[model samples]
Target: MPEEFRTTRRAFVGALAATTALVSSPFVRTAAANETFKIGILTDLTGSFSDLGGPGTGVAAEIAMQEIGGQVLGRKVELLIADHQHKANVGLALAREWIERRDLKAFVDVMNSGIAIGVNKLVGDYKRLAFYSAAATDKISEDACNEYGIHWNTDTYAQTNAVAASMIGQGLDSWFFIVADYEFGHAMQASMDQAVKKAGGKVVGAVRHPLQTLDFSSYVLQAQASGAKVIAIASGGNDTVNTIKQAQEFGVTRRGQKVVALLPYLSDIHAVGLKTMQGLRFIDAWYWGMDDKSKEFADRFYARFKKRPTAVQASVYSSTLQYLKAVEKLGTDDPGKIRQYFLNTTLNDAFLRNGRLLPNGRMTHDVYLVEVKTPEESKGEWDYEKVIATVPADKAFRPLSESACKLRA
Candidate 1:
């Protein structure tokens, strides 16, 4: 195996061992299985997406548990975490194990789209709930959607729609794309393509790169040569950080080509730095500095994790807390009851404002069109974005009338 793969595997093994030890400890063993509510978080703990939604996702869930006094419906809540290494098979296996043996009541923070879709199906088969905080593909709320699944965070259509239209309106009409060759990237780019065309803009050119790619020079050069007014990045996490860094190094932006990150996290901007990513625009579901409630939650989250929470991390926290509230209100952990409560209720939380769970298993909420602040413009650490506009819940996501989900049909 390549050294990188070997190193990643080693780290994953270490995480798995640690998780096993935690779960097998006396505290977990002595508790009657019926007295605990277990929520499993399957994430890319040691892969390229780790920084965006790894250990922090678990921390977010724990914070949610603490907010609810670590008990729900008279049952002590426990969190189980596993490193899926960004592989579909590894993620599915972990989800299966948790459901069959650990009595996992729900699955959260599934970052990989393939894994999220698979887990949604698995949980549906067994009548459990899944809250997706990181998966980006719209399929989770569309073709693969189930009554047991709730896509709490943003999806491909939500991520691309507002930003693409806003940029196109700014006269940055022609576009070229540097897409990650995966489900997330493919969906994001397709969304962007559709949005751009609908807005009367044209795609000049596009290039696809493998996941976890270190060098983006070829892709950046191709986009620069295309001379498109905008170079759209249809990826996230380290891939986004690296692409932005290299794009700046190659003077793609200096040459007057606007580079837009279709699905960037707050962590991505932090990694790339303001000087490189400044003036870049993207759509986001939440920002830590957006409001007083957001700031309060972010302060507490930073106190433990030492980093401001991203939208994905915040979603994990909000979804966990809300799920527990649903259980409390209904007096049971039944998937059907909790799912119904979520769909009928308007979710108002520090991380999501006026959120509504759609019939298609999509949680619709207001998303922001944010611009990266320059280093001088930033007030302090984690103060990276300025909200350029707020796309209301009704306009931010794909309209239910046009949804492909069978649930709606």
Candidate 2:
């Protein structure tokens, strides 16, 4: 070989060898592993829960990213979001792929209780962290509780006690229950029944319809025939919206019966519109324009999405921010230490106030009982709920003594 050519070839070979070694080196592998702190948001995007928990939850997480300055523990943050579609198999499949393939360290905003429980199981199995940001089934914090999962938003217990108590106190005593025939709906109906009986009211009758009943005429007629002074719809999201709208069509509302949403989200009221949902009472975990901090966040959120956020979106923002805070303090994503920090700390934020993450995975916080505003009473669009009452944190959930969490046992 010519002398100059030999020298050039040697330099090229050395560079190529260095690159090859770098690719196979353990140090490089570890660096790649620690390059990103990823969080997955598994939620309903195109299903019954979508109206209340669609892309809005993802937007909430992004705002948390902005608020946290876009980094945690010196690692770049990445958000992985997917539509669970309110299906168990779909949610579990997406969760498994994210956890195993993408190293998704945490998950948020699973809307359906069935899907939330499935994702919780995955988080438990992988010893990862997750927050049930939108699901309301209390069973996850009780019979199905796990160490790595925190059930953050409002649940059946908090919602029922506050809204039901207010309605009962208002002398809306006798009730007819129209419930969705699913895990979440059943749990809510049971809670509503307990509240009514405890408060000296009677559940005159009850009926269960399929998950996405296109028409609630028969159910509304049944409720009207029950002759109960109040009709309680033990459901959420689209189910609640459809029931209320159909009740009006069937003359159920034309009569004197009061319609109540047992687990209402701001989005549900928005979808059903103030004209239809007005006078209906419900409880929520957070209201966007409730206070100074809430309004501040809501204004930013509105600036981005051009629509007001729901309690479910607020749940996603708060839970994800709190988890990131733990990761920063510990300087690593140690699930055990993060879980301990969550269990021990009292969190106060735009979405929650003096909230405690219970040992059984229930994030306990005060919730509000709000009545939907009438069309004429509203100042502008997105002004839906008017706060009627507040239920404190300690009183908002199932007590540790009454819980079935193995942690309690």
Candidate 3:
């Protein structure tokens, strides 16, 4: 070979060898390679939980990306969202598509409890991560838990345990329950009933109403007729607010029984106004207007959506950020590894600090029992909930050893 030709050939061979090595590297050997870390946000955007789930959840995902600097590991992070419309089948379908087709590392911020449970099964079946952000059914962490999922927010057990025990301890004893007719309501009512009984309170009466009922007249009437000292509205968003409004209209509070609303959001309280919400006690994991951290986040959120953040929104943001962190740390979308990191890890961020994911999948953090402030006490439009007490995570939810999940026990 000619000298110049020999040198050129040597350089060309060296370049080709380098390229081949880069392509065959272990990090580049899998289907997950050449793809960004993808996460799915399956929530109710147009259903009963929309106000608490829709734009707010999107905001949370964005905040997570921003906090993580828009990348996990060396790959970019992408968030794909789907609306469940409060339907389990719909949510399950979307979850399957994201997991099987799009190769999402995890799904987050599922708002409906039924939808959460349904998706929990799908994630487990596929051995993928499900970072639950909003849905509060205890079953997600109890009978439904798997090695590949984590419920990163409050559950029925936590809410009921926090609100019921705290209220009962404060002397709100005899109870009348107005429950929504669904899994969420049933589980919550069961847990609340247990807490009330445990605290020496009696359940005087109970009635179930269809979800999203416009008028709670008859249900409120039943509660009133029970003559219970404490009337408990076990529902969320529109249902809880409507029941409270109807209870006020029916003169239930003025007559004797004080209505205690469970699982209320800032949006619901804002809708009912400070006057009606005054003195109404409820349980929450977070409030956007609580402090500088919350206020800063809420202000940024309102500036974008013209609405305040709810506990659900806060939950979504915290879970999304944590999931992204898991993806970065694991350096792969393997569900089993991600699951181990999530449940066995402690997540600290703007919303949740030193939060530990429980064996039953519950996020162990502080649960707040708050009372709605009167107009005189309120500071702003979204300044409704006044933190009455904080329930430690260990005591907020049912113990893991007591859970019915085979994966936990």
- Winner by TM-score: 1
Task: Identify the leading candidate in terms of lDDT.
Answer: 1
- Tell me the tens digit of each residue's lDDT in model 2 across 111-212: 778878787888889999888877788888888888987888988877787666777888989999999888888888988899888887888999999887
In candidate 3, stretches whose alpha carbon ends up further than 4 angstroms from where it belongs are 1-34
What would the TM-scores of all predictions be?
Answer: 0.92, 0.89, 0.87
lDDT of 3 at 405: 81
lDDT of 3 by residue, 233-332 (tens): 8788789878888888888878978888777778888888998888877678887766788778777777656788887787778878777777777786
Ranking by lDDT: 1, 2, 3
Model 1, which residues run further than 4 Å from truth? Answer: 1-34
Worst 10 residues of 1 by lDDT: 1-10
Off by over 4 Å in 2: 1-34
RMSD of each candidate relative to the true structure = 4.7, 10.8, 12.1
- Over 116-195, each residue of candidate 1 has an lDDT whose tens digit, in order, gives 88898999899999999899999998988888999999999988777777888889899999999988888888888998
In candidate 3 the C-alpha lDDT for residue 49 amounts to: 65
For residue 112, model 2's alpha carbon misses the true position, in angstroms, by 0.6
